[model samples]
Target chain A: MDSCQPDEKLDLAGVPCPQNSARTLIKLEGMDSGAMLEVIIDDGEPVKNVPPSVEEEGHRVVEKVRTGDRWKILIRRREE
Target chain B: MGIYLDNAATTRVDPAVASEVERVRRSAEGNASSIHQHGVNAAKHIEKARNIIAGSINAEAEEIVFTSGGTESNNTVLKGVVSLSSNEKKHIVISAIEHPSIIETARWLEEAGISVTYVSVDRDGFVSASDVEKALTAETVLVSIMHANNETGTIEPIKDIGRACTERGVLFHADACQSYTKIPLDVKEQNVDFITLNAHKIHGPKGVGALYVRKGVKIAPLLHGGEQEATLRSGTYNTEGIAGFGKAVEIAHTDDVKKMTELRDWFSKELSENIEGVLLNGPDTQRLSNIINLRIRSVDGNRLAAELDRRAISVGRGSSCSSSKSTPSHVLLALGMDSKEAEESIRISLNKWTRKKELGIVVKNMIEIVTELRMV
Candidate 1:
């Protein structure tokens, strides 16, 4: 497991794609530069779509790990 | 402020309506559901508003259930019917050009084992009654068709479709949010069992709308609480908003409709004469008087809308309600427009406040912009 602790956490499990990605972006927008945000999202479309969408906004996806039906994704806010 | 031509999405609330809202707020400060004098005062305001709204569509006061807005009213109808109907009655029929509220709700219902048939529209965005009739089945519980489309302003044959649905023993619901007060609507004459009406589109405050359920028509409630709105919709009444909605409806005149129709025609003629390759998106005569949707060849509608915005002339690329999406308009696509063609369309909806000079300015600017953009 990664030793780095996240500064923020958002549990978006069961939230559908596009909206989950949108919420994740909105949350990242409120964070400071280089702040780490841990987001819990549903497995299938969320896992497949969220990280790429986050990356497209110039943010970094630190890691992703499966936890039962949900996946926990670590995203670092883009530096301004 | 810039010239606003996106009235189909929402209009600037009339000053009179705003004053009525303010008056209602200052006069009463109690929940409309309570039995106290303050509550009774608030309830009276709601009842007065309900009566006005119901009378406009030829429905009774008790048949009107106030809701948050058109989206909620449509949702209440679609979901409410499914929840109350028997398992055998699992199917619904709707036109392909329905608002996103209806289309999306139908999609959600599909996930829960409800079947939906989206009847096709013609190239002019016209949904024929026969098409809707053909889509209905023995298990069809409801047939939903909008009175006039928000995107294209193509008026559907709601009366004919309503008659067909009634003959088939299926309930007919019409989303009249775009057509309310702008056109004639007689629920009894049309055989419409349910109608969705909203205030924002008619120069009233936002966040207030109504669903007209014909007397004796039973459906489950979407919300459960103090049983406000005859137990069909529950929550504290938006007394001020409802009063403003009534004022808006009361002030809407047939003369304004005639004025809008004449202005709309003149604007269309000017654009067609000056702008090369511009095509009207819907039927020329059988559409809402206020809406003018045009397809400009060799121009990106989104870019055109943004360009117009910079010039202080606001217009909508497809439905303003769904403008955030990069995808082309689903309504235009349903009307047989290709994806690129749909993307090339922009909607210009006028209001009672819109002046001829403003439309003339828009027309001139559009001609120059389309010409310049085509060169690129």
Candidate 2:
């Protein structure tokens, strides 16, 4: 499951809270349904918040991995 | 990863100090004003902390008044001094680069019929002694200047200003929140009538601070209540927080200040050499050893802060106390930086706990991120 490749790489690493979520949503809006987006983040609070919020917006969290202090979260767009 | 470079804003409470605070909070349950053994014990803690803080700053323990923090300390001093005078000596002089607490307090005094002269800083963010000398007037009752700037970390010429104030028979007050831990401060050497120190800035608990009022200065009380804090500031004492603050101060004084200075210098040198368009904001030698303000051209400060946050490198822009606002730093502007450059500036402050490896990581990540951002 962890070996699956992402359709698109979205490095949100180094971005602060709220802005990261907002940017991710904007990116997802531009993609087709079922298109995968890999988001890398270092802020701990946003890692917990962004995945659930993105999933609620009809996206699927394909992977969530804690690599050291950063999190690699892959989300697939499901619908509009 | 997750390097905390924003020590100027606030610091992580030292574990020992935190445990001390917790111990007081958990086991010592007594009001200092209560007439019981527990109260006496609490009062003893407060008194001991006061003595430690006072001794560190060369002030008598009785002259130290506890307050909520630096802002309250500044407000108390500004309002207290102004209210005590009804004569023609109603003029107050402050630097253009003082914290908002001092700036707003001065404005409030202006509204109350007091005259205010904002002394300007040089291009290096230093308030010259000559500028301060020129600003002093016959009616100038008090001269309030920050010992160190919160944004640029530029140390002011408080000793010269203090001497001038003494010669002119006017009072001198310094807000030393940013400089208290990083530099050696003695009230006698600085010749300051009042000095403010905050705990959170020195790895201590928040909501607690001390103001050093020289023994003979006559200033009205900001708060009216029971005769606490020598009747200068009126409120129940924050015994636990105060004790924590004292412990923090003791640690800061005894800790290797020179070693921290060397580390900060190395960080600054590394960042300047490795990063492009990284402009140092204040006087190279006159600024505090722990703080380095850098301007990364072509990137907005908000964006840079966000990017750094993503990299797990914590830094700040302008003042941490004023972080919510997106305004260009007023201190940078006072030092002749344009709004664009000011908006691109970020401050990185380091403490003793900061590791060299962490700073190396920060520099590498900062270079990569800034390069990536500039390309975009």
Candidate 3:
């Protein structure tokens, strides 16, 4: 759960759906293959929409944990 | 107490309306179509409700045909009108910014070999009546325009468009789902053949609404069962929901309209002054008073909505109709706003229950959040 590097954090802590996916996409584009991204979001539609959208974009969602109303999602950038 | 700024999506049922609904439900009311004593009572209640809803919109009770909700009402009008018309009169005109129900229904009509012209809106989201005039051909059967936009609160010039349709001998239908209870609507004044409104927008129970069909106008029915609602709409009437809807309309007509409008305007002025880069979406003078659409530059509306929700202030991003879709608002795009600007748009709608203190908190929290997010 703590595998992500401190400088590699992508905090989407208070963002909504689609935007979370969008920001995750932008961050993934700038990162090297196999780099990890830590995403924090509210648990609702995003919990359902984000992982699939990320996977479809060729990234791997490694861990998804629900802590109260917030969700911590980890995505690993895939090799092209 | 969580602030509810999503009134455009749906409103909490008023206590009075809820009580009326409960009373009807607890009675185990017989079917309005049945001939029993309980059925007679239920039928009487439904008739009273029909009258109340009709009087609120300045239409006859017979013109009000109850439906499940706005989507069904819109579908009924668009499909019903086209189905009733001859193949020669296959042309239909609709605004580009109409609700998905209308736009999608028009799309279906297009697929069915009907000619459809989508009239564009101005920068402020107002559809020009002259554009409708220019689009009308002798083969045009109907013109469907919304009375007020759900996202931007822009009120169209329905009366002028109605007059044009009248002169051209074309049927006119206006979707008044968002504006019916908040604004004054008169079928005669607008001269529209059909008007659609939903109960849930006005603090009434969900699952119930009415479509106003002008007397003597012929249209095909969307559903067939028990020959209910003059055979235009057919289903076992939702007695309790209709009762709540009637009570809500009565309350709206007598009490909430003036108070909510005042609260809406006050909230808009305060929010605009407090938040920098806030641009109003629709016309200042012509929009509905209960809705305020503002674009906060550089702050993603989805993020802003999440932050505001975290602070217990519940506003919405884009129209509730398009909330699940990932794209920016089509209505804003039609109004000539760039995609980025559309993504920054948030809709705040007020109701009678919205208080000044709550709005103050909302404005304060929104200003702080947007400021902080912009810096990031």
Give each prediction's root-mean-square deviation over alpha carbons. 20.1, 23.3, 25.0
Question: Residue by residue across A28-63, what tens digits does model 3's lDDT show?
Answer: 777888888888877887788778878877888888
The candidates' DockQ values read 0.01, 0.01, 0.01
- Candidate 2 CAPRI grade: incorrect
- Could you tell me the TM-score of chain B in model 1? 0.99
- In model 1, the clashing pairs are none
Q: TM-score (0 to 1) for chain A, all models? A: 0.95, 0.86, 0.86
Share of native interface contacts recovered by each model: 0.00, 0.00, 0.00
Q: Where is the poorest 10-residue window by lDDT in model 2 chain B?
A: B32-41
DockQ, Cα level, model 2: 0.01
Off by over 4 Å in 2: A1-80, B253-255
lDDT of 1 by residue, B323-354 (tens): 99999999999989899999999999999988
* TM-score of the B chain in each candidate versus the native B chain: 0.99, 0.97, 0.97
